[model samples]
Target: MEVGGSPTWSEPNGPPSPDLTSHAELPEKLRPKNIFEIPVWMGEPDRFCGLVVEWNNEPVHVLPFQKGYMIFGRDPAVSNTFVGHPSVSRQHAAIVWSREDRLAYLIDLESENGTYIDDIQIPLNEPVKLLPGHRISFASCFRRYVFIDQYDRVVKELRKSRPTVRVRHILVKHAESGRPSSWRGETITRTRDEARAQIQSYRRQILEKQEDFGRIASEVSDCTSAKRGGDLGPIFPGQNKAAFEEIAFRLNVGEVSEPVETLSGFHIILREG
Candidate 1:
């Protein structure tokens, strides 16, 4: 397997070592993993002028009429009411509540410069639910999108509606013979010296073909694998070329190794173990 960051491949003077295995192999349990958590009102905009609350939440009062009216006011018992404020000239930022239902609400700050959600300008003193994946812009400033979970809570929800395994991989080449191998079920070196050299060489090759790999793989990889742009899978210790296997096993999951060289060419190794 390739080691080091250069294009040249050099075999170390040693035989391969024993294989290694990961401690955990099963997927995580299907539960709320708290993918998104932030303090309440942490992302609120400065000079705020709008308010957003779910129907179940208690009615909120907007004091002094910055740019909108309060819900359940004195005169009219309107469920959703809007009143324009002359002093609130700037368009207030939009607050988004992301949920499984894909519901979003936008409140326009009574401003000369209007508020646009997904490019559609909203009327002053009106509240509109933003469309899915819609962009919310106020006076041209982009406000952060607030994601709400299925329970109607204001926490960033994990998009686990659809889940799939995310795999990363590497291909190894023999340094002396220039033969290409899939690198799955093979032995690798664990020595630091050997791995260092192999990784350097592979890194160089990857840098050279980085653009090509992104483009060519999109067109040439097998249908089953092409969707990932030719990503094969994960490579672990003793699972790939000897030089690469050593370093690949040491990395944490989601860590990508620098390029290394083997007899085959250059390779970029990603740790998904």
Candidate 2:
């Protein structure tokens, strides 16, 4: 069975050895049978974020997130979140939470099996920003930890009245857009005409060829949301440019929009909801 990160209560040393003299003074029933019976000490965590672990649709463990960071690994001596698996390293990865930015980042510590976020293996040591409901996996372990943001009250508030729309898009950037740098940090040199043609071709594939929009967006979209199959989840009004939202709001669910030009680039939007 897969094991999730449980707090490392103490050093990796096995349960403390009982003194012979103390054992002699104790009653027979009180005498220790084995080290396995010894209890591991647990204390209240201080200044931890409200990170909850759920099992079978019920909250099972409540892990407090510290301000700086927390480690995940096999060796309890070095890791804050301990996964007792052979494939996991002693110091596997870390989750660094930033209070000011209200964001958490996952950093792989040059592990043997690597760390993954939503099935995507992250680069070693380079911090990848995490969003709420993102699934994290260490090594080849089957257990996945879902990153929960306790500070999503604003999103909950917005959902009350102003409903949001989910969308997937593919962007074809050109040098004429003035900002040709893609989300992947690559420079786009295509002209406006070239970009327009590329976007139209993608639309045709989705409309006529019945190709998967998400797969196409993940393969070619210039936006960071490409990592999430070009999903820009729950876009609220004013969160995106006027030109982009104009076509986005007008389309019915499951409808694909024609090439829409924005300041960033030419885009083909797929209304998901």
- For this target, which candidate reaches the highest TM-score against the unseen true structure? 2
Q: How close is candidate 1 to the true structure, as a TM-score?
A: 0.23
lDDT of 1 at 131: 38
Candidate 1 local lDDT, residue 104: 33
What residue pairs are clashing in model 2?
49-65
Question: On residues 1-273, what C-alpha lDDT tens digit does candidate 2 reach at each position?
Answer: 011234542223332233311345777787533211101111222233544554444555656665356677765434556665568776788776533234566778788899998889988865577777887778877666777764466445646757678998998889866256788888788889999999999899889867789999998999888999899988865456567878888999999998998756899998988
TM-scores of all predicted structures: 0.23, 0.42
Worst 10 residues of 2 by lDDT: 34-43
lDDT string for model 1 (1-273, tens) is 011111110112121121111112425463212112221212222123333321223332322212222221101111112122222221243333322122334555354567665567877544465433444444533332222223222112323332223334433334222222223434333343444455465455455655444334344222234456546664322223445555556666766667654433445655554
Q: Which residue runs does candidate 1 get wrong by more than 4 Å? A: 1-167, 170-177, 180-228, 234-236
lDDT of each: 0.36, 0.68
